[model samples]
Target chain A: MEEEVVSEENVTPVDEAEGADQEVEVTEEDARLAEIAELNNRLLRVQADYDNFRRRSREEKEAAAKYRSQNVIEALLPVIDNFERALLVKPEAEEAKSLLQGMEMVYRQFQDTLKSEGVEVIETVGQPFDPHLHQAVMQVEEEGFESNQIVEELQKGYKLKDRVLRPSMVKVNA
Target chain B: MEEEVVSEENVTPVDEAEGADQEVEVTEEDARLAEIAELNNRLLRVQADYDNFRRRSREEKEAAAKYRSQNVIEALLPVIDNFERALLVKPEAEEAKSLLQGMEMVYRQFQDTLKSEGVEVIETVGQPFDPHLHQAVMQVEEEGFESNQIVEELQKGYKLKDRVLRPSMVKVNA
Candidate 1:
């Protein structure tokens, strides 16, 4: 800010010297016209810069929103590994019943976290299949389900808000 | 852009009308000074706006970088829940053996996902305890380990590129 004031002062002395000399030949209207033109040019440049800045910032904000969960997902991977280890061990003794209970609690916590962030499972079975949410893997003649209805889910599908993250793999009733 | 041009023309006509009438009463020098003052005022306002725009854009960029991982974290919570579900079920028979193996495979995939994103575990036991990476839950006297060295990790800690998301809970040798 101080530097701006200093530069302004530097410009003033030279302008005054020019004015004293030019005042003889140059009319006041001509001088005002020149000053207005210069000011208008500067104004246009600054306005252009402001517009570009606003556009770039908006793009950056969108990218940030799109990828916000990358780190947290990475951190929770080990929690999944721990769950697999506990499951593979096959809780042999009655004493280790608490181990299973603890895992269930953690699992619930994980689900709650996802739900709070608008991540949800795509409903497949018994519902009318939509290509946006479900991918048909096979067609089966199921007795109870209607035609074009999903009879079985081969792999789970997930969505983040309205956007499908992974389409549900399913078998459609013939 | 057309609106801007029209507005500029409107301003010019009014200024010219006023100048023609005031020309007899106001000296040419006074008119030049007034025009210079108006131009100076506009130039100052534009420069101030440019400064503010630059500062605002920089803050937006910082905010975007901070929240980049939020969505990915939300998406993986369900995967963690699936691991917990697989672990909770007691594998009572040989039929469940393949189920356990499938869970293990998913768990490995989760680990690989995290590793690809630069997430890593903070090593605690046998290493010198640093408050930045390890949160000491207890202190114990140990024969082999040096003072302030971690003896056991109660819960693992994780880091995402030098930034600790969760500190390791551990016991340090007194």
Candidate 2:
């Protein structure tokens, strides 16, 4: 009876060891599954972030191309104004008249180039003056003009493809 | 004796079953490790791609900004040429002289604007004729000029920064 009891005891411990081994394996597999789940989530997030970045970069590139000439055109506005003033003066001598004609052709060519680039003069004279398009230098009560009408354009304003470069300097009828 | 045989058989089968379970556990663990390594490699590749894309986008943005005014400047070159021609004429009458003076001031202002925008005239007369900067309209064996030297500039050329808008039309000595 004593030997039998010892044998039974040994068999019980072996069964217990097998159970412990199974439990350890199960725990390890669970941990690995959890790690895989976390990595998948991170990968998805990163992929989404890359997509958003690509979209934003494309939009920025388009905007840069659209407004590429804005800075140079803005700088040339004063030069255009001076050209207009100079072209208004009439020369009497034959030599100066020929020179003036050549200058007029250049001025017209400059205007054409500006137009092709989507630049346009902002209309002011006889039109209603809006603060967005015109700077009111003087306000007056004038006859033969409606109130808020632009009486004169002191200086020209310009627009480039729906963007205003400068406001027109104007006199408005109050 | 039969009972002893039965008990021995049962013990051996249990041990074998435990060994198989342990083998299965090791295989599962190895598979998880391999999966983790693969995921890590994929993540690293994606990250490297994103970094390259960002660098390329930044470079493209910089180039776009640098060459923004190139098109407009090219368009205005002929207009500038005409202005230069008009300015060379001499007026005799007082009225013509005053008109010419106004035109001269405008021309100066225009040139100043061009300079500020990094536009420059390419040297031709007395300089070595380069195909990149000068177009040889005529080749002559002219005296008092070195071989391959530009003797006369038929038309002015312009550069915006380091980029040539137009090559100078020139006469080169053979």
Candidate 3:
């Protein structure tokens, strides 16, 4: 009787083990799926980060190509000013006068080229003055103009692709 | 007999159903894990793309800022040429000479300012001919100089931060 009972308990447990192993595979599968889900989330984030990096690099290269001439252009402004002033002078000699005219033509052509390349002169004289790209050198009272109106342009301002390279010096009317 | 068989099948089927349910659950769990893994992969790729975009924008912004003034400087080359020519000329009247002198001073100051901002003049006269920054308009046979030497700089070249704005027009000697 004692042996039979022991055998019964052992056999029952063995039988139950095989059945449970076959049935409970669902829980093991669930655990594996959970692990895979976690891994998948991590991989997705890493790939996204890599994409962002590639996009950023392409944009950077384009920007490098776009603004390659800024410093040189700024340096040339004074030369333009000189040419303009030179043209304004009325030279006595025909040769000097012709030279001045030629210089003026060249200056205009140069201005046109720069305009084509996105360099622009800021018009401030006789316009409502703003501190953003115009510097006030002196203020005076004017009968017809509103306060803070630019009466005279002391110096011209310039912009390179919407960025102010230099501020225009101006006299404002109050 | 028919009732007995039906009852036996029912009794046997309970165990079978439990085992099948568990096995099916495991398969479902695996499928879920696979789905999660796929999602994670997509997420990672998208995230990487975003990161690349961000990086490119940043680089582009930097490059734009770096090369913004090239056009303006190129436009002003003729004006600079005019000033340099004026400096070479001897004025007749005292007032006229003084005015030219003042203009010269201003031009020098302007050039100095440009130098401070990274504008450089390409020195070519008396130097060996370099096609990189010098354009040979005419070649002259000379006794004192070797072949391919620059004798005179017709038009000066200017550079900003290692970029050539214009090639200098030069007289090459053979």
Listed for every candidate in order, the interface RMSD values in angstroms are 12.6, 11.5, 12.2
lDDT of each: 0.65, 0.82, 0.68
Clash count list over all predictions: 12, 0, 45
Q: Specify the poorest-scoring 10-residue window by lDDT in model 3 chain A.
A: A1-10
lDDT for position B50 in model 3: 67
Report the lDDT tens digits of candidate 3 across residue range B40-159. 667766766666767767776665665555555556566667657756756566545655665566568667867776679999978999888899999999878888999888878888
Task: Give TM-score, chain B, model 1.
Answer: 0.59
- Whichever of 1 and 2 has more TM-score, that candidate is 2
Once fitted onto the true fold, the runs of candidate 2 whose alpha carbons sit more than 4 angstroms away are A1-20, B1-31
Per-residue accuracy of model 2 over B1-174 as CA lDDT, tens digit each: 111111232244566765764565466567778887777777778778888899999999998888889998898888888888877877777777887788889888888898888899999999999999999999999999999999999999998889898999999999
Considering summed lDDT, which 10 consecutive residues are worst modelled in model 1 chain B?
A: B1-10
Reference-based TM-score of each model: 0.61, 0.85, 0.61
| lDDT accuracy of residue A167 in candidate 3 | 92
**Candidate 1 interface RMSD (Å):** 12.6
Expressed as tens digits, the lDDT of each residue in B1-174 for candidate 1 is: 111111122122445754563453245456556767887887788788878877977876775565455345435434554554555566654445444555556566666676666667789989999999999999999999999999999866766665776788999999
